[model samples]
Target: MQDTTQSDPNQQASTTPITGGEPRYKNILVIEDEHFIGELYMRALTKAGYNVKIIIDGPSGLKEAQTNAYDIILLDLMIPNMTGMELLKKLRDPNSTPNLKSKIIITTNLEQADEAKDEIEKQADGYIVKAEVTPKQLVRFLQSLER
Candidate 1:
């Protein structure tokens, strides 16, 4: 099995101020089927002083999301077991589970039509096209959410 825990070496060098007096480590969950993309996110987010966990499939990712409180969730539209949209709906449904407060961001390469894009925009906190943003940009975006 591939080791899932990966962190960037320059994380300590980050200039972003740790919230409060001490560093507040935010928890992040990444639901992406692509190993390369997952690794890239893990490294960048970790470098930005966040604790991140990665799940490659939707079912497992959904379970994890339901059971734990994450500061952010990076979800891909396509994956094994269930689609990202399905998982997002479940997570957002208050009756479906308890403690589903994570901010979900759709991160995908899939191009959506106008209607689909509008629906996704309504459901998710943010939508990021994978090709448009680099790992650093992702981290910076997440930081903006802290304010």
Candidate 2:
């Protein structure tokens, strides 16, 4: 399988100001199983002036994503209880959770075929390989969504 672990150019061109005189905190939800990775993302996003919440499993994460409003969602593919793909489908369905308008970004370690990646990209706003980007870079990517 090809390693499609590169940042989107459009995302790289984002010039949104994450911090300024007053803190403009954008709410973010992170659905990751690994404690270390989730904490890393929380720290980086919090430092970048974003309100971040993390859920370790898919079921609770899906509930949180549905009940609350968030600017962005960082999702892991291979999560417990419910998979990220299942959550994505539910989140995308207007009838399932009508108020969920958060931009979903897949942040996973799983490798997939090119066709599968394309399908996932169509479903999600963005995709990132966990090993490919630093926390700081992830922040930049999230900032890009503001534009």
Candidate 3:
């Protein structure tokens, strides 16, 4: 595995909903190996005024997630270099990685058994089936998370 993280130069500042007539910034990290999906998410999220970045593989995703800069992390289960579940475990482990501030959400089309799904849900802040959410809807979903 290599450190293949590519942080875009267009990375915007964090954004926040109006509170006290002031703007706050929020950073979102999307970990999806699929290029099209990742770009779709990036466009939607960036349009919504979030500082969004996309990492296309598990190792880079994991490295970026550990930085504690992102307010939200949208992760895919199937990724190159490593599995999302494995990355999630590391992120959640207090000994291995502690005080992570990002809200980790699992976004994948992979179907799992009830037991497996439950287990993933237990480890992640939220889970969404990719097939069920359009790019616009994903932004809306993220808005709900902010509230």
- The numbered model that scores best in lDDT is 2
User: Each candidate's lDDT (Cα)?
Assistant: 0.84, 0.84, 0.82
lDDT at residue 57 of model 2 (Cα atoms): 91
TM-scores across all candidates?
A: 0.82, 0.83, 0.81
Ranking by TM-score: 2, 1, 3
TM-score of 2: 0.83
RMSD list, candidates in order: 8.9, 9.8, 10.4
- Residue 73 accuracy (lDDT) in model 1: 90
Candidate 2 has an lDDT of 0.84
Model 3: per-residue Cα lDDT over 58-116, one tens digit each: 88987887765788889999999999888888888887667687788999898988987
* Candidate 3: stretches off by over 4 Å: 1-25
Q: After superposition, how far is residue 13 of candidate 3 from its true place, in Å?
A: 25
> Global CA lDDT of candidate 3, please?
0.82
Q: Candidate 1: which pairs clash?
A: none
Scored by TM-score, the top model is 2
